[model samples]
Target: MIALSLIPLYLVAVTLPLILAAIFGGPPRPFHQELASGLGILAFAIVLAEFVLSGRFKSVANRIGMDVTMRFHQLMARTALLFALVHPFLYQGSPSGGQRPWDPSRQLTLTTDLSALATGIAAYLLLPSLVLLSIYRTQLDYKYETWRLMHGISALLIALFLLHHTIYAGRYGAETPLTWLWVAMTAIAVGSLIYVYLIVPMKDKRQRWQVSAINRLSPRQWEVIVSPRGHSGLNYKAGQFVWLNIGHSPYSLHENPFSISSAPSSGPNVSFVIKELGDFTRSLHQVQPGTRAYLDGPYGSLTIEDRCEPGIVLVAGGVGIAPLLGIVREIRLTGDPRKVRLIYGNRTEEQILYADELADEDVTHVLTEPPQDWQGETGLIDAILLDLILPPVQVQDWLFVLCGPSAMMDTVEDYLIARGTPSGRILSERFEYD
Candidate 1:
């Protein structure tokens, strides 16, 4: 909840320029021109703030969840673009040129300096390209890491150009105080970039981890475990995940986030349940034990801690059971006595993993395709299945933790909400959702 609580503070930091400009700005220009300047100022501030909303901040990702933070970053970029796009057209008939001798304050004339206007023109063109590339990232052929690098570099260039243009030509930014404030704000935003690229990697050098074991969990799923070399392991709650980098240096950009399937109560060794999906995931089988590993995480807000719910209902589909297994294992390890039910669904019987290892207390295993004489629940875990698992009176107080395909999650969430379950009681982590 740290990031959720800090949202108001984040808004204040980003809107400081607007607040200061409204108070200390010079005599108002024509309505259209003033509107143009105001919109430009707001856009620049929001663009700068997008750097910190990139899901690398522990204070943000750990509290609101990385999915929420990253989604906000993507959405805000488009909003800032709309503002920047409309700004120039609003200044249609404004007087423009070098500051006139008659108008010493330049209140009547907008600057037309080649250097200032050039930066703005370049930034205006680049901003939309950056936003479009991001929105259509998956539709393109480039690797995810390549897209990520391009996104960062393009953003940095845009910020630099916008800073130069804002200070040199902006009506409010021309003032010494507002100019300095923008400089400070831009520096802070860029500082976050430095922290993620340099500082975090340097810190990882002191606390390294190495792969201790790797084993196939199912046909397409593998389990990898790592132990801290010389220190205590992560202090993460169940249902959290980390960016795991194996056989790569701390500075390498070859990491992917995976849920920590092992419970914190299971000693210093942490485990991950990874399913073969992309380039890196498919190569999990080739990874050897004792490989150098680095972790940047324990991020995500999905957890059962401090909850007053009488029981927990875990709804998992196929490999999505990874995090829920951690919660179930932890609960059993501590013997907390809270009633827990697991509703696991898979397409075929062979897809199920850890079936014998799982506790049988209210466990409902559902398979869409079953062989002859196959006993147990069959078919999709939908309304019909939910009705059998959840008693109507118990739905309001039980915590529902869901992870699966977006369709399954949406259906389960809608059903829960429709049946009197409070929104807060239904927790989910949709990191790759977008």
Candidate 2:
């Protein structure tokens, strides 16, 4: 059934280039190289629009296949560029068996044809931009938003240029199936973009959250509690996160994902404990109560409900403790008496964000520092602590949840594995961006 459904898509992917080749009189075997190229370009534009319009990039990145979707996007962009490169080479070649004295350099020198030159230049400019932006997204963090907007605009420009290039070069200005196909694809792409940019914002405004209170948890950490003003409660499981836009400046695409620190039982008021880590977070204190905020999810699979084990082990470091705290609070609220142990790690005693509250919970604290008078576990969390604390039970019967800096989680996972913990029972949540 799935294969049958994918047949039309497969046909579109494969034959679009052939149609282009035939239309352009570029390749004899394939109907038209230009028509095929047009279809390829149009199909890619549609896919790009679908991704952006559905707002699934981040969700796909974090959930369906972590880091894999990013690679796929990069691959598709490169493939589009390759198709663009092939169009000129294939079209200029002789349709007959004999070799023709056609030179690519000669074709480049002809500038009297403005449409062709524009199409070539647009293709040259846009393809490389797509590749470079996808590859260097993180490194060019400051220019990310500008590059993203430019990238979208450039994609549209490339599509328009390709359409013109096809129409003029192939002599299929009208009354061509390929022309209609191109038109339909462009309309779909444009409509999707409009909906994503316009209608989505209006819907988001109606779903906006109002800040109830912002409590200073520590010197730099704060717990921002918010609830939808004219809406019912947000149904989210423990450990899932939400992307928050505190000031709702549409131009300020500075939404950051934060774990819900408070349990869902806390009702309409969802709490996010944030530390002043970046420019956006540092400015959070200035945000007024009742300020409009946009929320984008309930993502991630780190909840305790997902685990069906006799006992649980939660390892957290710094603010990584936020989600773990939610899980703990949830367990307490439900009165689920499953044995849960926590090995909370921190750089120093002072930096431990939720020290008093964690101490009050029925959980163990493994601090990285012990004062002169202090007599709790100290130094990096290692196998020694695991051997000392972890109870004797079948490894599969216990679920280990690790949330912290990647390095800390890696170390803890390795130690747990060495101590006979089954690989399936160990789950780690990464809070960092790729």
Candidate 3:
């Protein structure tokens, strides 16, 4: 229900400016000028809303899933950029000058004031650069933190610039009510950043955690366990994730999101199965036990504890088994009667995690490169493998949870839907949407 409410809320926010303009606007300008103003208003509104859609807000992300929130953020940013790009072009043929004496409402002339035009021009150039850099961030040589800082600063600047441009140069923005609306919305947008960077960290300083243990699970994977120090522990459902900051200050940007591999029923200590991928992850081997850490979440909706489905199907690829492991442990620890099956896929047998723990469960392990004496199933978890492992009855009624590389998840989801599985029954979470 919370997720469904976001759509109408978003529509109202983006269209509110247009509605107010129509009510308070003194006169209707030419179609081109109105088009220019409407697009400009919408673009600014969307950019402001992007601040809340950064996937950091638990109220939004926790219910809808972080992956979906981030995808929406990306798509809307591009759309706003397109709207901003086309906004000025529609007013090209209009006469450019200061407000005329007879037309105090400025309906017949475009503002030629240098300061107002400068803000709009500056935003015009910076918005595109910001979007392009984000789209190709991985291709660049900068560190992730550096890129992140630059992105935030750039966005804030764009918001400020757009706010100034809208209030001073917009045909409808000079009205008192519309101006106040923009100010309030901009304040909320900027406050979201302050909340994320400063307020959240200040709160985390009290509820600290420490690395209790770190163990190499495989050649490329490691298990990190953190125990709460001053508090009881996190109150997260099994299969959720948290942003972990290790050996860094609570306010530091050196945090990374990882799924919890430990079940809530087990203990307060939370475990993460991390594979060496980014710079922070590559240094996991060197992290010492008892190092101070802070967690900023219990985010993501990749959980199954509340579901009424009679059976559960867990599909994992490589280290994507982290959250699924938590779910399996929860079921075993709590003695849940619902039947559970885990279809775990990896390149080799050695890459599999918690083999002994999962030995008793109905798990089908798939290996792309199995050893000569291997007895388990071989090849990727594609249509043929799924058909062999999952019977028709199970496919129709069971809840399917997936977390994996994008390609694997897409293949599994597409195949599952083709087999008549309802979309609502299949839940998935992705860390990398691109």
Q: How does each model score on TM-score?
A: 0.94, 0.69, 0.97
Q: Give the better candidate number (2 or 3) by TM-score.
A: 3
Tens digit per residue, CA lDDT, model 1, 242-341: 8888998888778888889998898999998888977788998899999989988888877899998889999999888989999988998889879998
Off by over 4 Å in 1: 1-4, 368-374
Whole-model Cα lDDT per candidate? 0.87, 0.65, 0.93
Worst 10 residues of 2 by lDDT: 103-112
By TM-score, the better pick of 1 and 3 is 3
Which candidate number would show the highest TM-score if scored against the true structure? 3
What tens digits encode model 2's per-residue C-alpha lDDT throughout 303-365?
778467888888888888888888888888888888887888876666677677777665656
Give every collision pair in model 1.
Answer: none
Q: What shift in Å separates residue 431 of candidate 3 from its native position after superposition?
A: 1.5
lDDT, candidate 1, equals 0.87
Q: Where is model 2 more than 4 Å wrong at Cα?
A: 1-117, 120-124, 127-195, 249-254, 360-395, 409-429
Residue-pair clash count for candidate 2: 14
